[model samples]
Target: MTPHSVTLDLGGRTALVTGAASGIGRACALRLAAAGAKVRAVDRDAEGLAALERAAPDAVETVRLDLTDLAAAEQAAAGVDVLVNNAGLQVVRPLEEFPPDAFRLVLTVMLEAPFRLIRGALPHMYGQEWGRVVNISSVHGLRASAYKAAYVAAKHGLEGLSKVTALEGAAHGVTSNCVSPAYVRTPLVERQIADQARLHGIPEERVVTDVMLTDSAVKRMVEPEEVAEAVAYLCAPQSSVITGSSLPLDGGWTAH
Candidate 1:
């Protein structure tokens, strides 16, 4: 964690953060709540939501709803001043062997759900003439990996969606951008390590150093708080001019 945080003052704003049960989403909910925004922490995990609310008992409102429920997801996003599309799951398999059902679920949660949430948030945002949409994209959004077919595809689609929202919402004082990070030190990625190990027939430690951090000049995994900090920066007053762009926290993976 950084010794000093870049404080963002978001008084009177209602921010709805998806995937708030853990990892990057949890950090964002906490950071925004600390910034004085009324945070609606949404996640499918009821117990995780409870834990998150306990962390900021007065500042965060917990909403437990699966994003796969498109209508419910849209309804949950209504009237939110800031929308953080951060909920995602990954399935690793080669193209011919990837389960169609899992692929469908991944896209539904990662891509279509963001579309519905953004749709629901737009009327309020356009009416108020001020809003922020921060999509928690991945480095896979920019670059592809072998067994992560579904994940890469969903993130790439999300990148396109974010840019389109930026273009359409530009005139209405709404800014939509993506914060793309490389391997984060989250359980999801830890599970991914196991998946990659099995796929490559390698040990778990070898998967981490050789596969996960191969392209990253900085070999260490990124912390969730770092990604959240970038999200907070994009929501600050200084970020009004940074629409339709991607902020990469990939430890210089793209430098190659």
Candidate 2:
């Protein structure tokens, strides 16, 4: 038997990326499109999804969706070879001050939605005998931070769910893995910065330095494209044996 090339060539394949409107999800959609995948780019933001469609008009199909709607998520997953569970939200506040509804909202989107999508996509992938699942977790998934109980707990659960999916999908030729990244320059992170500053009574600059980047040995935020490259790698023909893994693209945030 011969091994396939390390580089991904997704020509003729279809990929569905949640949260494809901006940030890491947008980057992953672009990269997968560049690798020849037919991308179903999904997000709650219609305008953002339209922008993504404009940027890759030929390769992308925009789908407006709220992952919190499990039926809609399942409908979106149909006929896709790759699933990128990237839709997420962040809320930073002291545990005692966290709103109950806000906590549930974050957990629902970040953890429950991904789980539902994976379950919905399983039979399709199993029937096809080839599939890939990429869950975009966070540095908080592997570690902890103050004022981020919901985000951290959801990410942690997502990582665990990915591992279980990997185990179950092994015999069916499907693989599941997570790409955990450090803070990136995205709208979500920017919002977190403002919230953290207000909560801690610190300058926004310090939020980046003392909060997000405090554990990162590299002293820089992870690039969205860098995380996308890892997604491309896992989608390659040769990465069949790479399931049940959480690959950190976190600027060495966990090294300490």
Candidate 3:
């Protein structure tokens, strides 16, 4: 909503952004492209990808494929200078009632997919001696909420994966980090609003104020652009020394 002040020049770099068709992914795609990177926008949503490419001034190449196809997901990241793993889905249910298939898919997409993508990306990065791996995580990554067993588990695993990537990539000039944000105004979070309300036995209207913002000192959902800005900053030249770190965009939730 506010003006973007920071400037980044990634003119010659090739950036691959997963889930690039919407929300924070869309914003990150646009931001990186604006910084002059040859961005390969990956998403399963063809319609959304088309809209994104049409709206851009330059050509934004899009890969339309589901990340659950692990081999394809890995292949999609080949030869990119920057990788942003942002594709994820959430299933809200108590652990006892959670569907086993849903949990497996969640872990497959969020955790395993990132692993394969990193596996696909590292050789190229190590060969070139430069790369950036930015994972879009959430405050739930650092904390926890009830009735989100699968989502929380996957994020926690992702946090670990990101750190390990950072350690292994350090000597190779490949820095891996996570941008952990609180609730953002995105489709994923929007879908959960009602679920949260029902689980907590609160009216839908109260979900946003009382539940979502309970630990958030700011009491407002984060804008996708704000999260994108952090992503941009992490990939910038100045952030060379910052790696294996969890950058919190939590609206003060983690400050507790």
Best by lDDT: 1
Which residue pairs in candidate 1 collide? none
Per-residue lDDT tens digits for candidate 2, residues 46-154, read: 9999999999999999999888898888878888899999999988889999999999999999999998888878888999899999999988889998899999999
lDDT tens readout by residue for model 1, 150-191: 899999999999999999999999999999999999878887
Model 2: CA > 4 A from native: 1-6
TM values, all candidates: 0.98, 0.96, 0.97
> lDDT score of model 1?
0.95
Q: At residue 8, give the lDDT of candidate 1.
A: 86
Give lDDT per model, in order.
0.95, 0.91, 0.92
Query: Candidate 1, which segments miss by more than 4 Å at Cα?
Result: 1-4
**Candidate 3 off by > 4 Å:** none
Best by TM-score: 1
Worst 10 residues of 2 by lDDT: 1-10
lDDT measured at residue 226 in model 2 versus the true structure, 0 to 100? 85
Query: Candidate 3, residues 111-138: lDDT per residue as tens digits?
Result: 9999999999999999999999999998
Stronger candidate by lDDT (1 vs 2): 1
